[model samples]
Target: MTRIGFRLALAYRSNIIMTCVALVAQVFLLRMIWTSVYGSRPAAAGLTLDALLAYLTLANLQAFVTHTIVSRIIHDRIRTGMVFFDLARPVGYLRQMAGFQAGNTLGGLLLLAPVIPVVLLVGSITVPVNGAGYVITLVLGYVIAVQLALLISLIGFWTMEIGAVSLLYRLVSQFFAGTMVPLAFFPGFLGVVAEILPFKYMGYVPAAVYVGHISDISGPVVVELAWIAGLWGLLVLTWSRAHRRVVIQGG
Candidate 1:
């Protein structure tokens, strides 16, 4: 399944190209916006222009790499009555989805290889303060993202259409996840809200760690692990109920 997903992603040349183009465009556009905001200033919000740009660049790339279509795929399969075949397989359905998403993420990472250099050149992005910490937190962030996506996909079990729900999730997650702006700029209650939410682990935490906004990764890592554990428990319970629903409906 992983290989199949990787091959499918690679085969979709137009998608890869368009995604890269869009990412590049977004990087430059964001640079312009931030430059204007920082006019004649070296830093604001405790982050230098370069560091802030780096954070945005890495956050955008991470968001793109972690993107998942699992919800849409699950919804379509359920609607077409094809999901039961997956349930009957020896392998667990969630495991299979995770494997495919992993492959898809790898494909996205590959697609970003060239684009990364372009953005780095244009943005003068700073190197990660703690390379090892960045790597560890980023991987943890990916795991958290996958689990969150799976939880969303599980909604397909009850809903006939998940498009609206998925869209709402994307919008909310993107905003709170710090893909559009760093949580540092969220302001008062909004900042407090973002800090408490799991969404920050998806984009903000890892990027902040990379750019040195998060000097100590220990706290964020612990929070991420806690969220991962809690989310997994929720996922297990949800999947159990979803499985029973599928069985009853199929009967």
Candidate 2:
């Protein structure tokens, strides 16, 4: 399944190129904006321009790598009455989705490789202060991302057409996950809100760990794990219940 997913990802050459181009442009423009914002001001919210750049670079990379294609895959299956065939396969639906997401992540990383050097050259990115902690957080972040995406994809079972819900999820995730801006930079109320949300653990915490903004990694990691456990159960339950309500669109 993983091999199949990998091959499918590799097949999308044009999509990968366009995605890389868009991400590069976004990172470049953000660097300019942050640089201008911090001109002659050493730091704001304890983040220097260089650190901010590093954070943004990693956040964007993580966002790209962890972005989900599962919703569309599931949606198409349901639409074409293919999900019934898929559900009957021995592999099981959730694991099948995971394999595909894993493959997509790997393919995205390949697409992301070119942008890393470019971002590094153009912006000052920090090295991880606690190497092991950073790695742990990063791996957990991917797990959290996949789990969240799985939950979203399962919503198609209820909503039938999940495009709007998926879009809403993306926007909410981007904001709360700190992909758009660091949670620390948000207004006081929103900052507090972001802190309480699991989204921050996905992109921001890992990037912050690498850049030395987050020194105590245990708290965030534990919270992220808890979310993963809870979400995993939710996915299983949703899948079971959704199957009961599923209506095959056609033969």
Candidate 3:
């Protein structure tokens, strides 16, 4: 195996196990929160006990699956001059990184495979998703998540602060994408804003669509496609510029 492949495999396997541990812990904590919240006033007009539990489970799973903090990849490489090796290689640097990310995602999915069934069995939870929707939205969100991470990593060519930047991005994404909590809990104005952004499609919209909370899937699908197109276009532009910048800067 290539050094990059092996390194990614090792990291991905370790991180995914860690991710499952974290996910289980978070789910239990959320269950406690759900108990407290439902203890006082059980149901809202739209949200229910089942819906609430459903929301918590989906939120945890999607957040765990889709979250990527790889901006550090480039920052680490660049600071250590490991990026020089990437630049000298015959293959396109973007292709190399894409392969690495794919392997990472594969390992992540692998880790989740066992943990997910165990969580459901122990917690007595059934997902809001089915076979076909699961396959489609899972793939879509996975691609979106990876592309987003890549776009952020590309920022390293200009900024060394990608670590801090990615932290900030995750924080904001929680609020905007409704990953911190579902947008259904948000007040009217904030909910409106969340609906408009592509962030929701990445986490809430897809999950909800698969789970059947989202009645109108067509609109979100269109918007998601637009965002994917925009992101891919941006990725191409940024990759080209980053490559050119590195060649010219001689670092």
Candidate 4:
């Protein structure tokens, strides 16, 4: 690995540790609240207890997996002009980011997955079964989440202060994406609205899979893929626009 790669890997290790700790704490807290409130209630209007627990776990993981302040990475680079060097590199800008993500994800699985099940076992909650639909939906969720972050990061092309933008992403993601609570809890009309928005694909639709709600997942998948395709187009378009304005240092 290059020096930068090594450095990023070190940072990735720290993220993995912190993420695992956060997941553990949050899961226990959620279990406490859920047990108290869901004593015997259906997971959500009609979801089974087993399904709810699984959804809870998967949703928690999804939150961490997608949890990142991406705008800062690009904003800081832009402000300091370090990204100038990136412009001249042989590899594409987005490819560099994909490398970092690959490393971070690899490091995260070491801690996040191995310890999570053990912690869940303490609650004696039934682990969510990985049905074919559940697995496919969740995999799709991961892809959309990465796209969401990339979309946010690309905003640095036009905005200097991405803090507010990133915060906006988090707010919408937490509430609308079903990370904080399932969309099923929302009013029916509101839930239907959430269903159509691409944001829900970030966490909600996948959690639905964990709960076996994918009687039909085609629509959700189509929506998510459309967002992915659209966002990638936007990212490329922004890059093309920025290429004109960006001051290349070494070129």
Candidate 5:
């Protein structure tokens, strides 16, 4: 499944190119915005201009790498009745999806080879404060990302068409996940909301750890582990329900 996903990702050469182009453009655009905002000020919210730029660059790259289209896959399969074949397989549906997503992530990593240098030229990014801790949390972040995507995808088992729901989820999750801005910059109730949500662990925590915004990863790592356990349990329950609710449309 992983090999299949890698091949499938590479098969769409145009998509990979366009996505990289878009991400590069986005990085530059955001850099300009942040530069203007800083406007000679050294730092805001404990983030210096350089640190903020690095955060933006790394966060965007991480977001791109971890992004998944599992919901779309699930929706299409369910719509076409191909999902029935997935159900009949010996492997657990969630495991199959995870394997494919892992491969897709590896493919994204390969595509990043060219983009990384471009971003690096744009600005300086800091080395990880805790190399080992950064790696552990980043991997944990990927798992949380996949689990969240799978949970959202499972909604298609009942709704049949999850385009709107999936879009909304992406928008909300990205915003709260610190893909756009760091949760540290979020004010008042919004910051509180982001803190309580699992989304932060996906993008923010990992990038923060890399940028030194998070010096002690012990707490965040613990929270991430707890979220993983909790989410997996929820996924199991949801999949069981979705399994029974499957309705084949046009086979």
Candidate 6:
């Protein structure tokens, strides 16, 4: 299944390239925005300007790396009655979806190689304080992201199409996941709210860990693992219910 997904991802090379370009442009724009905002202040909200850039850069990469194409793919399958074929297959539906996401993430990381240099040159990307922990947290962040996307995709079982809901998911995730602005920038109450939500594990936590904003990694790691377990349970429950209710219409 992973091999199949890898091949499928290879077919989307052009899309990956475009994504890299867009991410690079985003890094550039963010660099400008944050630089202007900092404007000689050494630090704000416990993050130096360099730390902020590192956070944004890593957050964007997390966003891109964890992006799931399965929602669109599954939506089309459902609409065309092809999802039934998947259901009939011997492979576990959840495992197949996860394998595909893993493969796609590998492809995204490959594409990221080019963008990293640009970000490094312009954004002043820095090494994480806890290099090993950062790597681990980074991988966990991508896993959390994939799980979130899968949950959104599974909604297609009821909606039969995810176009509108997918857009809504992206917007909500972007804000709550701290891609728009660091959670540190949020007011006290909102920051607390964000911390409790799983979205923070998707980007903010890992980015903070990378930039040394989070000194003790155990707390965030434990919370993130708990969220991952919670999300997995939700996915299992939702998929079980949706699979039973599925009634392919029109095709």
Best by lDDT: 1
Model 1 lDDT, full chain set: 0.85
Model 3 C-alpha lDDT per residue in residues 1-251, reported as the tens digit of each score: 13555457566687668878888877777777777777877676477666666666766777776766455666798888898888888988777776776755566666688898766653346655454655566567667777788888888888755778788878777667666577888789888888776666557766566557776555665666777888899999989888888779764
TM-score of 5: 0.95
For model 6, the local distance difference test gives 0.82
> How do the predictions measure up, each by TM-score?
0.96, 0.94, 0.87, 0.84, 0.95, 0.94
Clashes of each: 0, 0, 0, 0, 0, 0
Return whichever of 4 and 5 wins on lDDT: 5
Cα deviation at 104, candidate 3, in Å, is 0.4
- Give a tens-digit lDDT track for model 5, residues 49-93: 888888888788778877897777778888988888888899999
Q: Per-residue error at 51 for model 6, in Å?
A: 1.1
Model 2 root mean square deviation, Cα atoms: 1.9
Off by over 4 Å in 6: 247-251
lDDT of all predictions, in order shown?
0.85, 0.82, 0.71, 0.68, 0.84, 0.82
Candidate 1 Cα outliers beyond 4 Å, as residue runs: none
- Backbone collision tally, model 3: 0
Q: In model 1, what is the error at residue 25, expressed in angstroms?
A: 0.3
Best by TM-score: 1
TM-score of model number 3: 0.87
Q: Candidate 2, residue 176: CA error in Å? A: 1.1
Give Cα distance to truth, residue 60, candidate 5, Å. 0.5
- Tell how far residue 215 is off in model 2, in angstroms: 1.2
lDDT of residue 154 for candidate 1: 92
